[model samples]
Target chain A: MIKLSELHLGILAALGGIVLLFASANFAPLPGQAYGAGTMPRLIGWCAILLGCFMVATSLKHLPEMAKPHLADWVRKPRLAFAALACLAVIVFYILFAETLGFLPTSFLGLLALMLVLRTKWPTAILASLATTLAVYYAFSRLLMVPLPRTEFLSFLG
Target chain B: MLIFEQAAALVFDPYVLGVILASAIFGMLVGAIPGLTATMATALLVPMTFFMDPVPAIAAIVTATAMAIFAGDIPAALLRMPGTPSSAAYVDDAYKMTQSGRGDEALGAALVFSAIGGLFGSIVLMTLAPALAEVALRFSSEEYFWLVLLGLSCAVFVTPSSPTRGLISLLFGLFVATIGMENPSGEPRFSFGNLELMAGIQFIPAMIGLFAISEILRTVTATIPRQKIPRSDGHGIFKTQWKNLKKYPVQTVRGNITGTALGILPGAGADIAAWISYAISKRFSKTPEKFGTGHVEGLVEAGASNNSAVSGAWIPALVFGIPGDSITAIVIGVLYIKGINPGPTIFINDPQTVYAIFMVFILANLIMLPLGWLAIRGARPMLSIPPSTLMPMILIFCIVGAFAIANSTAGIVMMLIFGIIGFFMEENDIPIAPAILGMVLGPMLEQNFITSMIKADGDIFRFFERPIAGGLGVFTILIWTLPLVMLLLRRRKQARLAT
Candidate 1:
């Protein structure tokens, strides 16, 4: 919902770059070498910082406008924003519950909830999600042989 | 000729042929869906490629990517949504063509020209690859570093967006590549003590999140009314293309050449090729003012350009173990997974696979004709799928695709995080392609830089001592500084005019 102007993004980038430089300050270099694990990262940090500064400098003439905060249109519409958040929520939910709930139940719940949030009818959402979850499970685990986590308790679905 | 027979034998197997057919369908379906990209399709194919043999696996990716790049034109022509960024270059022209009741012709030209362009690039790839590999074999670390840098430069500067944003995206990608413990020091740089972080970010999940999930999020938030596809006037698709081909033979050849050249450049891909070719097409057009008004001229050129560029990108990937585009970046990963490490020695060590890959390119482009025709015929149904239902379906696939990568939840978590980042970056106008390229090329850049630095004993000027390295170094430096020079000159000229 938040729309950060280039100026703000630039500032954030600069701060991030600085923080990266500090965080990797103690990364041990390869033996008898000055550059190592931190070398490329350090170079990236510097580049980011420079780019951030460039962004800030170029926008300096429009500082007032750059400082003005704005909200994306989706932010004004809670329903749309919630639908977007629902996407992230589904992923987080599956991650937290997949092992305990098993892949099927967790995936089904996630898919159905997302579909319903997006305003699909409950019947269609449930049916489609059920079919999708089953199809995906079979395609990946059976056909592709990815070892998706199985529920310890939900043996039938497992 | 014996080599051709061997390659033909390898690819003609039922298993490999089946892979090609299945992947072609997958490519078309994925490409027809608005907001999904060919690169995303390749990323999704990685896990499936894991179960197959080397030839079939590589064949699947090759066929899928070539088909997908061409298929992206379908939605661009019909719905004005541009299924992939490559199609975005001339989406307006395509949609206008549809609006003016030339939808069938626009699509027809796109399919035919795309096939021809892809074929042209494939031929170039076939003929040029072995010789190029010989040259690449002579490349030292200094040459490679400059080449990668040049590629990154092309990625940033070539886009129609702000170069700053492109740089930001690219830097983010390079930073992502630096996350693990496999750097020059073998010390974990940014793991933060997380075990998964030590292994580094999985490329496929991150790519899926960046492209697919972010696209879903964008679709959900978008307000544009989905265009109602104009009913086909039944003018027949390919009927008009013959005249178009004869009319624009020069543009066709130019587009193919530009696309293939750019494609061969690491980090430059079909999107840039299409854009550049479309620009060139307009520049050379007798009726340049007719552009952006449903003119098939731009579409014909750009359509051909994008597919050819798709083939062109394989040159560096096959010869130098460097990716020519995001799709080929994933292909390189698959190639490594299949134990077909892409490099100069690949021609010497695995001639059949190399030739088979070339043969696959030709076959993929040829197969695109019938499959593409079917996709155009079926575009209406594909376009009818509402975003509300479709987004959720794609999201599930993204989840499963990510999860399938390592059979770990880490991949999913990475996807979610990247999805958010990608959505954020898109909203801010930072291009995602450069970031993807950066991620793909970052390790190569660092590896080459460090190796060169160590070899040269930290003498900076030593980087330009070698002939080819010197030439490449000068070219890269010029590319970086040329804009600045031109900018200053333009300002001075404006001052003089004002006075």
Candidate 2:
């Protein structure tokens, strides 16, 4: 992840406020009323704009230090960076594949991959992943009736 | 008397007791572990609570949070690492006590005083919330608008950080709340034609992402090395508490009073309460010089405080639907999910449930003695579980928990997006509590503001026409302006000094 400086955050907030103000400009008001849905958004936008300006103004005194965006320490470590990306990938993978591949397979694979990346031993990782996958499957699907995705391959287990 | 029986029957059932026991254990584990907070435990428990009835659901949360706050002292004393932020205030004292082989005394004081404080807060909540709700019952939209604004203002200005950053976080949350067509005009604001977006962000998923997933990301990518847990000579966890109680009667009462007072304030929770109570204990003590070097005075005071604040936070949440802390912010979300609309009317309509919750507070604190002692005895193995193995398991839970909210992938996607946003916010030193509070209160703020506007025919001055509304409005405005006045005064004084 990138570590943005105060100035950058302020600038981004200012831009965001501007965009909000313009986007909500077209919202129609309530019947026979001067304000509508747009009123709250517009208020938030103005507040954001003022806050961003204040932040920017306060940050100007240390302009040189405030302008530089630095990378967090973990971003420089290859192992830790991989661990972070691997965590995100597991979630993204589950989103894309859970419906087709079923919760059991998708969760097991994701958990296994993440555990391995985090340097857990292979045996413990596989066992823990499988156990967790099944436990979550039963808890959510059977107990809570959450309707977690299922496939023919895991139908027997269910 | 009949209502008390009804509430007792509601709380003492087999299912509710079962739920309470399970959540008690869960809260202890989460609170005893470093980096896993009481709020995170509540966020994770929401999914399971989704499957429960109202009483059991609330019982789970109430019990879990109480246990978590006390269990946090375990790691704080044994490892010099607070299991939760609430325990950070007296960590030095607790750890030093352990170093001096007074670990039992330290843990015992924490357990005994924490229960005392919790009971004190619960009594206050029972007596105070109903009375306040009576007044809240007569409030109009104009008054509600000002009240909600006051709560938000307190969230920003009361935070111990840059108000600009807190305001930025709050604005971001309000903007998120405006994503759907839940407004008075019924116009789609930022949905961009997607059905899920039109429904607005799922509060559960967003909460899980913000509190749980962001924590996972930070833990996984952290560079800090884990510390070794110190050896503890544990025995007679309760033997020494009677003497300590007798010795520090004033500190115990003061802690409870200070904690409950701070807890009633919006956005100040157990963590802040503990810090403030510890400071007060030092300020008022004769031996203030012995504060940081294993002094039990500060520990007794702060330990009582953090737990009491847990119960204190429920006051505003139950009475006015304004959360007193982040934990109650999550509780408010859970309440809404259970189809229990929080506010003054809840007292009239669901008096049994309200009383049951009060009962749960007392039960949770009383049971903390046994549960807290067990956690202390078994702390070593629990802390030894490497984060490498635990983070992945937690992530899986987060993924499935998000997915279970609406049985859709859209919830998962929302969790992912908000997780990254929460991580970024924390990295920038922006507080997450105000954002959570904003998300919870934004719709209420908008609805009341618009309702008052319509009722008053767009006349701004009419907002102050009602006496309660006028006083509240003026008070809210004063809170916002007072800080600026102080800032200007200080700056002018600095200039004069320079001259």
Candidate 3:
């Protein structure tokens, strides 16, 4: 876990730098109109800088009250962490495969993989995963008219 | 009379009826699923609605969402799991009601009261929105600027524990809003050398990240060891009493009215509406202690208030083209994409469309009553599903939902970012609401402020000089100061008493 003081200091420094970057950019001539792209960013940059300063001050003065991040706890629960990572992997695979494998097969694969990871019984997992995949496929395709990718494999099956 | 006839025609349409029924059922299913919020459900549906008639689309979407919100109570009451944040308040009470074999009664009361509240909210919206818009038409950009400021200020209470952090979050959101090309000019700002950034952060993906993925991460982190409470095969699973409803009519009406009024207020959404109504009811109750311990009145009030919020949310969406909550924001986006302008001029330009949407509300609420009844009757069977099964199913929804939005691997990546950030934030009791409010309102504030500043020729004082802007500034100041004043007064009183 990062110390609150250190976190505050780092966050503020980063915010200040980001603000300065915006301020250094060529600014618009008018307040609302854009002579350049930098105007609104500058305003937001200043607000961030000010808030960062306040956060730094508050953290310094009330260190006990400052919040500490709990990355360690997450690290301790390796299974939970793995589950979360598995979730991300499943989603990434779904998106990648949606175009190639198409919606149905890909969705079913993603669900089945996730179900296994979640420790669902194999029989129920296969059944429910298939039902959900088919239901969503029908809803999106026939009812909502969303154009899901049609792979050659899927077309051949049809 | 013309509007009435138009509305009546909408009511009589069979396709319109079908749309409402289907949408509401879908919404309920969406809401009942853990981590699948009304906003996510609405966003997923919003784009599809583009192909449909605006009237039926709006009706179906609204019906689905409203029922979905109520359906959240189902999980809360039965499983001690809140499907939506708005249902969070009554979760304890409703769950307790279930444990005591009154779960069916609690669900019944919530369903009936929510129906009543939705009707009341629509009434308030029908009366108040047009009048407000008529008044709002008089507002120049100066007033518009103030109104936005006032809205941001009201949002301050949305995360009361950390006001400074809230303001910082808002500023960050505003900064994100600036990333895209300038609205007034074609010039790009904050693109940081990326074309995708030039379009700015898409609200839907950002929302999906914040609400859906954030929740999944939080749940994974705080994995509660499932308690094995004996499953009661209680018989009165769908029993609700008109007698009980009549007994608590005052509570239901009060909750509905308060929820609607709060809903109409910019920046106040269903979560606040439910909280505020619950508090008011508790305050006025003769036995306040009865709250949080399965009080039927508390359940009735919370349900009604959240229901009213759905209607109340529409006032801003329909009249001003501003969404009061995430769901309404998606609806406003839908209207924008559909080329249906929703401002004061919209009423005059498309009265029939406006009436059609309103008529949908009337029909949606009516249909929700029967649909709600059937769903509640069928809920106990749903409770039989083991958490193990649910965890996988929800995980699938979360995965597909995150991916389907932009088809970007970046969205899934962003979901991971927000989920981690959100889990940590919740762990520290730092509150997730401010971060979300920051994400939601940040860009709007920037755009309005930049636009106002441009109009004022860099004169910062001009922001304070306009009547509406000045008024909002003063109100913001008052809101910011009054809490400090109360704290100081309390400290002083404590000192004097000790002396």
Candidate 4:
């Protein structure tokens, strides 16, 4: 991930506010009233624009330092960066496959993979993954009746 | 008397008691771990609470937060690593006491004083909230608009950060709240044609992402070496507390007052309360030189203050539906989800439930005593759990918790997106509390604003026509402009000096 300086963030905020203002411009007002759904968004957009300008003005004094954007420290370290990406990957993996392959397999695989990436031993990772997957399965699926995706093979377990 | 009995019956049920016990353990576990906050604990508990009845659901949260705040002291005393931000205030005093073989006393002061302070705040909540609700019941849309604005203003201004950054966060949250078709005109503002987006951003999933997932990312990517947990003599966890209580009665009471007061203020919570109480203790102490070097004086005061602040934060949340801190911000969301709309009307409409909540507060504080002691005794094993192992487990919980909220992949997707946003916000020194506050209060602010505007036929000055609304509006505007005024005055003074 990139570490954005205040100037960059301010610029982004200003652009975002401008986009909001244009998007809300077409929202029809309530019948016979001066405002509608667009009113609050417009107000927020204006505030964001003003705030962005204020931030840019205040940050300009440190322009030499503030204009430069860099990578976060974690992004510079391969191992840690991998771990961070692996965490996001696990979530994405779960989202894509939880419904298809079921919560048990997807969660177990995701947890074990992330654990292994984080340097947990294979045995500990496997056992912890299996145990946590089952525990969560029962806690949410059975006790709480959340109807989490289930595998035919794990039907009896459910 | 009947209402009190009904409230007691609601609280003492086997199920309610069981939920309290379970959440007490859960709170202790989460709070005793470094980097997991009481707010995180509350966020994690929300999904489970979503399954239970309103009373037990609320009981679980009430018990968990009270326990989490106290449990934070355990790691602070033993490892010089505060388990939560609230414990950061007196970490030096607590750790020095441990190093000097007074660890038991330090932990005991934290546990006992925390419970005492919680009880004091609960009593204050019981006595004060209903009385204030009477006044709140008379408020109208104009009054609500200013009140919500005042709360949002406090969230941006009172927090220890650049107000500009806080306002940016607040604006982002308000914008997020505008995504659904829940607005007055029933028009989809930013749904982008997605079915789920039309329902608005899911509060629980967003919160889980903001607090839990971002915390996991930060913890996993950090380069700080883990410190060895210090061995402490855990015997007599409560033995010295009595002596300390007697010795520092004034400090204890003062801490309770300060914490409760701060807690009642919008956006300020236990963390700030602890820091302020510790400062006050030192400011008034004759032996201030001993503050950072194994002194228990500051611990007694700040420990009490943090827990008291937890209970004090509920004041505005219960009475006005304005959250006093991030925890209550989440609670307000839960209450609305449960169809128990908070505000002064709740006292009149659901008096029994209101009293039951009051009862839960007292019960939660009392139960913190035994649970806090057990946490202190078992701190070594709990602290030994590696982040590499724990982070994955927590991630799975966050994933499932987010998914379970609405039983859709969209919730998990939202969590992931917000997780990255939260991480970026923290990296940029933007405070998350105001954002959470803004998200929770955004719709209400807009609804009240539009209602007042329509009622006044776009006459903006009529917002101040009602005396109460006028007072609140003026106060909110003053809070907004005071800092700018101060900056201008200081600049003028500087110019004169330079000339």
| DockQ for each numbered candidate | 0.63, 0.66, 0.37, 0.62
lDDT of 4 by residue, A1-63 (tens): 777777887888898899999999999889999989999999988888888887799899999
- How large is the i-RMS for each model, in angstroms? 1.8, 1.8, 3.8, 1.8
TM-score of chain A of 3: 0.77
DockQ leader: 2
For residue B450, model 3's alpha carbon misses the true position, in angstroms, by 2.8
RMSD per model, one decimal = 5.1, 6.7, 5.7, 6.6
* lDDT digits (tens) for residues B280-396 of candidate 4: 687689897787688999999999999999999998899889887899999999999999999889988888998999999999999888888788878745546788887898789
Error of 4 at B15 (Å): 8.1
Candidate 3: which docking quality band?
A: acceptable
Candidate 2 per-residue lDDT, tens place, B1-499, comes to: 8899999999999999999999999899767755467886787788888899999999999999999899889877875656676786687788888877788889899989999999999999999875643554567898879867876775675343577888888898899999898999888879999999999888767866776677778878888865444555555689888889899999999999878866776666787678767866876799977876888998999899988888888998998898878889999999999999888899889999999999999999999989888887787454466878878887887787777667899988998998888888878787665676577679889999999988999898999999989998998898789779999999999999999
TM-score of chain A of each: 0.89, 0.95, 0.77, 0.95
**Pairs in clash, predicted candidate 3:** A31-B454, A32-B453, A32-B454, B173-B442, B174-B442
| Cand. 2 TM to true fold | 0.74
For B135-196, candidate 1 gives per-residue lDDT tens digits of: 55567889879977876776676444678888888889999999987688788868889999
lDDT order of candidates, best first? 4, 2, 1, 3
- Residue B486 in model 2: shift from native, Å? 2.6
Identify the leading candidate in terms of TM-score.
Answer: 1
Candidate 4 error regions (>4 Å): B1-130, B158-161, B223-361, B375-382
Give TM-score, chain B, model 2.
0.64
TM-score of every prediction relative to native:
0.80, 0.74, 0.75, 0.75
Query: Which window of ten consecutive residues has the lowest lDDT sum in model 2 chain B?
Result: B226-235
